[model samples]
Target: MENIEHLYEEYAQTVYKYLFSLSQNADLSEELTQETFYQAMKTIHHFRGECKISVWLCQIAKHLWYNEINKKNKTRSISIDDLEIPVHTGKNVEAAVLQNEEKLALFRMLHRLDEKTKEVMYLRLSGDLSFSEIGDILGQSETWARVTFYRGKQKMMKGRSEWNSD
Candidate 1:
């Protein structure tokens, strides 16, 4: 077997990012990334090389994140009120608040979407995954993933315009 260190060096950031996308907690994601590599080392023999190594590592990270959340009895969705959007308005506190509100509204609009579209948005926006990877994960074609993401964007834009008019 090649060095596990090499594998960790190559894939740690990708696995961490995948965990972060799902958890949005840097600390938890880091811990899960380590755990993911550990688990992958243990099960490397089972990896039949059917999928990209990065994808397999992310699958491990995803499972560990879920297990961590279950242990903490936490919901997948964090409380929107507790979030602080990092949009820099500098000295303009009112502008910052408005920006945060807009981000929260976007989240709400995303939450209202159909499950498939919502998954597409989360994978595209948060996971920073490619359309092909998202399609592979979702068991759909690359074109389907691209179209779902485009449609999801359209829905969010329409919702935002409507929200602004309110």
Candidate 2:
């Protein structure tokens, strides 16, 4: 097997983003990201090379987050107000404000989705993984990942339309 050090350099950001998408807490994400790598290092002997390392790392992160939440026995609400939009896009002030507002609205709607669907959507959108990769990480089929994401997208669109008409 290769050095564990290289794995951190290659997959840290992806793992961090995936964990952040799940927990929506920067500090928790950071801690879990580190814990995920640590667990992987401890169990490196069991890695079968059946999937991409990134996928494996994400699976570890997912499990760690799950265990943490289950142990705490309380759901942590997503703090939309804590989300920051980057300002370097060179957009006009009005455009930036509108963009940020739209993102906030989208996130609020996303939180309304069922836990599994929301997770699929977050992994696809924020983690930037393909349906196949998501399936590997979530221990499901690619078609399942695709359909869940499609349904989630439809729910978001339907919610947005209803809001617009009200």
Candidate 3:
């Protein structure tokens, strides 16, 4: 019990960050994070202590996230009210503008990807899961996961280039 509490306290923020990265919605991420812990508590009795607790928790979170995403075909909407366009305080106006442009470009590129590729990218980048772990999560081979990630990155780059051309 004490050990479980300590583990949760230490890893909660990391779990939340991973969840937020995957969902991109504060409310949904928070809800899913809670769900992850709930499931973890119920299943902890089965843990073999063979892997890092963080990794196990992340796996749980990833599964829950994918389940939620599949259950809802519609993309999660980002409300304008949640947008945090950083204001430049001093000499970084040009840098800030470039950063904002990059962010918009990335967002546009992401929107162009199909669901599978997007999931690969999100799990890889946001979840920080290795190719093998991603494979397990997505039910694909590690090589397939790698291929999907590379292809998705290429697609995003191509989309970004086309957007720039336009």
Go through the candidates in order and give the clash count of each: 0, 0, 0
| lDDT of candidate 2 at residue 45, scale 0 to 100 | 88
Q: Point to the candidate with the largest lDDT.
A: 2
Per-residue lDDT of model 2, residues 139-164, tens digit only? 68899999999999999999989988
Give the number of colliding residue pairs in candidate 1: 0
**For model 3, how does the per-residue alpha-carbon lDDT over 1-166 read when each residue is reduced to its tens digit?**
7877887898776677678778878898889988888899899998897766777887898899889988776766778997988767766998888887888778778778999889788878776767876665565788999999999999988877887898
Q: What's the candidate order when arranged by decreasing TM-score?
A: 1, 2, 3
Candidate 2 lDDT: 0.87
Q: Give the runs in model 1 whose Cα sits over 4 Å from its true position.
A: 1-3, 74-91, 129-144, 161-166
lDDT of 1 by residue, 28-86 (tens): 88888888988998998899988777778877877787788797786556788879876
Taken over the whole model, the C-alpha lDDT of each candidate is: 0.83, 0.87, 0.81
What range of 10 consecutive residues in model 2 has the weakest lDDT sum?
82-91
User: After superposing candidate 3, which stretches have Cα over 4 Å from the reference?
Assistant: 1-20, 23-34, 40-87
Query: Considering summed lDDT, which 10 consecutive residues are worst modelled in model 3?
Result: 132-141
- Backbone clashes in model 2, listed as residue pairs: none
Q: In terms of lDDT, which candidate is stronger, 1 or 2?
A: 2
